[model samples]
Target: MNSVIDLLMNHRSIRKFKPEPLAPEQKKAILGAAQMASTSSNVQAYSIISVTDPLLKKELAEFAGNQAYVEQCGLFLVFCADLSRLRNVTENCGEIFHQNTESFLVASLDAALAAQNAAIAAESLGLGICYIGGIRNVPHKVSEALRLPELVYPVFGMCIGVPDQEPSLRPRLPMQAVVHENAYDTGAVLEGIQEYDETTRRYYRERTGGQTDLSWSRSMADKYRLPVRPHIKPFVESKGFKLD
Candidate 1:
């Protein structure tokens, strides 16, 4: 296999990281790679904050579900879906900011794609990284911590550093399950998911010494079973994004 394809296929989320800081030159290269990612309409409606403040990292760790890796990693970047710049430009032109759901989704997607590019770049440099989706758990706290203004929102956070442990590659669903033809096929999708459960079950059992009895379906159901788990609608409203 080609080196790039091999690297991508061997992907695993790294949670434990070494304490050594990344070199300045290396940091620049990684960020440059991220900037190279395709942006919607070339608008590049995203901003990344390279966080190094110890106190702020601690607070963010807490806000992000006490994920220790967030504070432990050598570099922490909070990727934001920023519309504030455009908002200001429009205001200067005597126009009001139209904060709609579609705009929010677009900005969020832009931030995510950019972040993924950075993650891949970090991995290429032998650095380990993990994305903290818990950044969304307490959206207001995240915004306040980052000092984000209106029309800007924290989509997610990423940690980058050398690995402390070599984690096993997690199994993925089969290609047949995810690859759909011209028309969508739900039956193939369901069957693929079922096969994936068995694959994941074997993976979890082997990796954790048979400690975790998790299959994909059960684990997913457990997640959805929780109501009021980090209530977010009100937080999104506070961020000035009208969902409905």
Candidate 2:
């Protein structure tokens, strides 16, 4: 109901950007906000790598499915779930390092929280932002390109810059589908899905000038009918994460 809520409601992925870099102060503010995000038990197990080199950004863009915005954005940040720092600290403190699935999840969630804060701070400064999850498609290649060490893996990337194009805000599922009162409501969820399908169908059609008529359910089915990113497990394990 306020400026914060208004900003949150208008959130959208910006794929096009103006060819201008952020000011030093703007970058500092955004990163400062990210560092303040909540962490699990003070284990701020995350690291951000700002890709400033043109060649490195180009390589990362390739690793992230050739997404041009990754190279075009004024600031490209690679958020990593970094347990290496924590492990080192623990070892130095004479405590045996112990990690499992729970620790891995905590680190990933920590990175995500920090990234969201950065996105909001950037948007508040009249900057457009987009999250590039496509980096996960070739996580190993991205890690190698970034020279990430063990216990540190790229969670995702973010593109931040001035907007060159305005895109429509994508519709989300109804509140009833996501929020439940006191307990899980299966019927409400199914109803919400059914309702969202119609909204998504109309969204794609209007967005594409009636050339596309796909529903959310159908698109999700197409995406999941095939095993999506089967290599993620092996890749994460290769990074020294103990999923068990």
Candidate 3:
């Protein structure tokens, strides 16, 4: 309805980008917006790494499953959920730092919120952005490369640059399926799944020029059929996080 809404609705991941770097003021504004994202109890338990070194970007590109966009993008940022800073502050004050699954979840959510804000701000600046969850594929390596300390982990990475391509907006599930009125409605969700499956099937066909045609449900099933990132729990624990 409004310009902001239109901008939000039109968001799509950018896989290709121009070689130009962002303006200094543009980077500042995006980061300022991210820092203002809502945090849990003002904990502000997140950190961001701006990877500008060409060698480092190349390494991270490999770490992110060899995604060339990670290296090609003008700027690549790693958003981290960091409890280490809070622990240092608390213990330095002679108080025992309390940490558990709740704290972990809060930190992760904080990182996500800040990242979304950064994305919006970048988009508003006419910069295209894409989230790279593949950083988690080799979390420990990424941490070591970035010199992350204990109680800090990379939540995800982001690539930002001038857009070199215009991609079609991907469709989302019907609102009725995702939004329940006063309670959870199973029937509505199932109906939504059925409808979305067909929509996605057609989407894949058209996008791939009929080379691929798979329902959303089938794709999800295939994905979940195998274990995904089984190393995550162990890696997080190794970083001194107590999942208990």
Backbone clashes for every candidate come to 0, 0, 0
Error (Å) of candidate 2 at residue 92 is: 0.8
Q: Write the per-residue lDDT of candidate 3 for residues 54-96, one digit (tens) a residue.
A: 8999999999999999999989999999999999999999999
For every candidate in turn, the CA RMSD to the true structure comes to 1.6, 0.7, 0.6
Backbone clashes (count) for model 2: 0
> What TM-score should be assigned to candidate 2?
0.99
Instruction: List ranges where model 1 is wrong by over 4 Å.
Output: 227-230
User: By summed lDDT, which 10 consecutive residues of candidate 1 come out lowest?
Assistant: 228-237
Q: TM-scores for all candidates?
A: 0.94, 0.99, 0.99
Q: State which candidate, 1 or 3, has the greater TM-score.
A: 3
Better of 1 and 2 by lDDT: 2
Over the stretch 42-160, how does candidate 2's per-residue lDDT look in tens digits?
99999999989999999889988999999999999999999999999999999999999999999999999999999999999999999999999999999999999999999999999
Q: Each model's C-alpha lDDT?
A: 0.87, 0.96, 0.95
Error of 2 at 7 (Å): 0.6
| Over 4 Å off, model 3 | none
